[model samples]
Target: MKKLVFIFLTLISTNLLAQRPQTEQGKGSLAFWENLTKLCGKSFEGEMINASENDQFYGKKLVMHVRTCEDGKITIPFHVGDDHSRTWVLTMEEGDVIKLKHDHRHEDGTEDRVTQYGGTSSNTGMSKVQFFPADQETTSLIPYAATNIWWITLDDTTFSYNLRRINNDSSINVKFDLTKEVDTPPTPWGWED
Candidate 1:
């Protein structure tokens, strides 16, 4: 009877452990997810701090609205001037992994060819920062962006979204002031008010 009880207890314990997220990275991802969710329903103004004159975002008004937050996903619309086609979607998957996806849409509410291209967090990023490297889907969708790596950092005073291309010197950083909330922009393309 003792032997049977021991075996049963061990099996139950193992199964419970298997069901939990297993890595330190997973815990960090959860922390990051919670921090991001706190910004839901807020909008902030930002600017591309490193954009060159030729960049599309240069000299344009930038706004990011943390519009939606639900059980396992957060959607933030990024408005660049009058164009309302870009959104950033963050999803919390099983094992506590976080996925970042760029959702782009046409003015008529149609998906763009380069839509839904981003990656997942692969390391133990902190509660205020996370990094995502280009996933296979991103490479398959945008051949030239195979080496892209994107990161977002948040703090009491600022929130920054950044991208870097591996093996290349190209990069962009957009910083939004967290000290003040801006007027929320119009609904992004394909999303209702």
Candidate 2:
């Protein structure tokens, strides 16, 4: 019975430790998430850093609101001109991995047919930048985009979103000036203002 009790205590302690935030890695990743959370309640205008004439967002009122932030997740609504349907969701995954998802919704709070496509990454990057590769859900949704890699770089001066479609030689980079806070735009589809 004493052996059984010791085993039970060991299991409980191990699980408790796992649930606690202790190591530097945990601190670093949480710091990265906090860097983004700090932008909450603010809106910034973004422009495609690299654009061709055919780019739709090139001359539009492109905005991103680091609108909603919580302890382990943040929801940023990205607006293009008058389209309020795209929201970027970032969640703290197990330990240090961060999950990225694009939540597309209709005006009536219905999920778009093509939505929630992203992945998680344990990117050993600095607290300012993290990369997420296409996950299984993304591939199942968009087979051709299986190699899509999305990365966000956040700093005191800028917050940029970069995407590369591997094997397709296509990339998109949009950078927002953190120094310029814009007027808040309309609430995103499926979200309360």
Candidate 3:
């Protein structure tokens, strides 16, 4: 009777443990990223506006090219003062997060004047990067709260980018409205459909 009771208790404990919820090992489940596969292969045109009053920077026009293959790429041609321009390479990461890297050189190998334009996704659902000007001290580019961080959303004929910036006081929000060309769709990759 003692051995049988012990066996029954062991079976009950095992059953309960199996029924318990299993914790995810990686970044959340795919349900958190529903229909995210549609974001790939979309070409977009947008703008990166600087709404910070403390800084003298203003708004700039930007064009983004997002390609989805095995290794996806997002190229943003950012327009600065006058003819100054740069291209930012936004790459996807683990669990669909993005990392933006800067390239101020043109195709002819000329240097453009785009400053402080590289960042990675923060844990707070925002992309955070540091700004170190020649004169001012280094600081993080804080978009207003979690809303200012922008991502690319696209459909067959329409593409939109919603960019938000959190202010220093954490009370104000700055936003930019961007639109893209509707006629042209990106050429499908050799491997992509």
Give lDDT tens digits, candidate 2, residues 72-133.
88999999999899999999877667999999998898999999999888554557788899
lDDT of each: 0.90, 0.87, 0.40
How many backbone collisions does model 3 have? 4
Can you give the TM-score per candidate against the true fold? Answer: 0.85, 0.84, 0.38
Give the C-alpha miss distance for residue 147 in model 1, angstroms.
0.7
Pairs with backbone N, CA or C atoms under 3 Å apart (clashes), candidate 2: none
Assess candidate 2 and give its lDDT. 0.87
Residue ranges of candidate 1 with Cα displaced over 4 Å? 1-26
> Which segments of candidate 2 are over 4 A away from where they belong?
1-27
The digit string of per-residue lDDT tens for model 3 on 75-178 reads 54443333324454555656555555555664345554443354555421311121111111112332223233444443344444333354433222222232
Using TM-score as the measure, the top candidate is 1
Kindly list the per-residue Cα lDDT of model 1 for residues 136-189, writing each as its tens digit.
999999988999999999877888999999979989899999889999899899
Which sections of candidate 3 miss by over 4 Å? 1-37, 45-63, 67-73, 76-84, 93-97, 107-109, 113-116, 124-193
Task: Sort all candidates by TM-score, best to worst.
Answer: 1, 2, 3
